[model samples]
Target: MRHVKDVTFHLLTHEDAVELLQFERAERAWFEQHIEARPECFYTLQGVAKHIIDCLALNAQRKMHPLIIRQRGVIVGRANLRNIADDHAWVGYRIAQGAGGRGVAQSALKHLLTEARCVYGVTQLEAVVAVDNAASQRVLAKGGFTAQKRLPGYSRVSGAPRDCWIFEYSPALSHGLAANNTLY
Candidate 1:
């Protein structure tokens, strides 16, 4: 694990599976019963663990990557560079409930975007955020992503199809430079 500014983003390993499962358990237990959320967390631990395993496997190929976000040595969030495209990757993130409002997600995202451009050769990145998640939308906006469109029924939030705001970022558009090369 290496620190990104004040936060640490760690490359997950098979040995992290158990700890990740435990983190997911606690996170789910706390967030599942909330007012609004993503449906992916509605599954049983067995299913969730399977999902994490699949993520880990995909990351192993360098086509995708997931990182656990920690602040001050405490697990606080998770983010992923998912659905990689030619010269691009889709990004998503979630901050623990108690960790919200402190700019943790924003800081993590800023660092991740820099790493993506400088280290991963990602020329473009995109994110789809639920319309009502103002905090997340703010994070993406702060990271230089602009709203591309509003897709109707883009995701299942709390078992209902919710509208999503699509955001896209390019190094030229964000940092005024092109991607150099892939870090790996």
Candidate 2:
């Protein structure tokens, strides 16, 4: 677990299934409009239980890091590093509707990056944002991600093809390499 300001970034566990389910159910409609639509099963208790179990298994295999974001002990969002391969991972995040526009996502992402580097030894991170998600793009930029390319028909949102902006973050590129060839 990591704390940033008033927000806490925690690894999701089996015990958190109920809380996660409640949060997801509460934000389902809002999330579906802004992010990719989740499978219908994802909103159920059974599905969340299975999802948590799967996330824990993936973490044990060092293939993914699923996290929950909390503020003052209340679950407010989630962030994850998925599809990890080599030294890179794909970054994804979501903030509750009431929690938007407060720099929460940016701060949580910054903390996640630190854990990614120290714990996972990840050197590069990638994020894909829907072309119309200006807020998410801003958060990525605030967290030091740079847009690399635009992928057309990259994903489906609400069952329709959507364009996406690919962004990348590399510690070696953001922080100049030292004479010892080590990331700062």
Model 1 spans with C-alpha error above 4 angstroms: 1-6, 29-49, 175-184
Across 71-104, the per-residue lDDT of candidate 1 in tens digits comes to 7777788888887656899987777888877878
lDDT of 1 at 38: 37
Across 1-184, the per-residue lDDT of candidate 2 in tens digits comes to 1224578888998889999999999999999887788899988999999999998899899989999999889899999988887789988889999988887887777766876787888879999999999999987776777889999999888889999999988875555422222222
Candidate 1, residue 57: how far the Cα is off, in Å: 2.2
Clashing pairs in 1: none
Candidate lDDT (C-alpha), each: 0.71, 0.83
> Which ten contiguous residues of candidate 2 have the minimum total lDDT?
175-184
**CA lDDT, candidate 2, residue 95:** 94
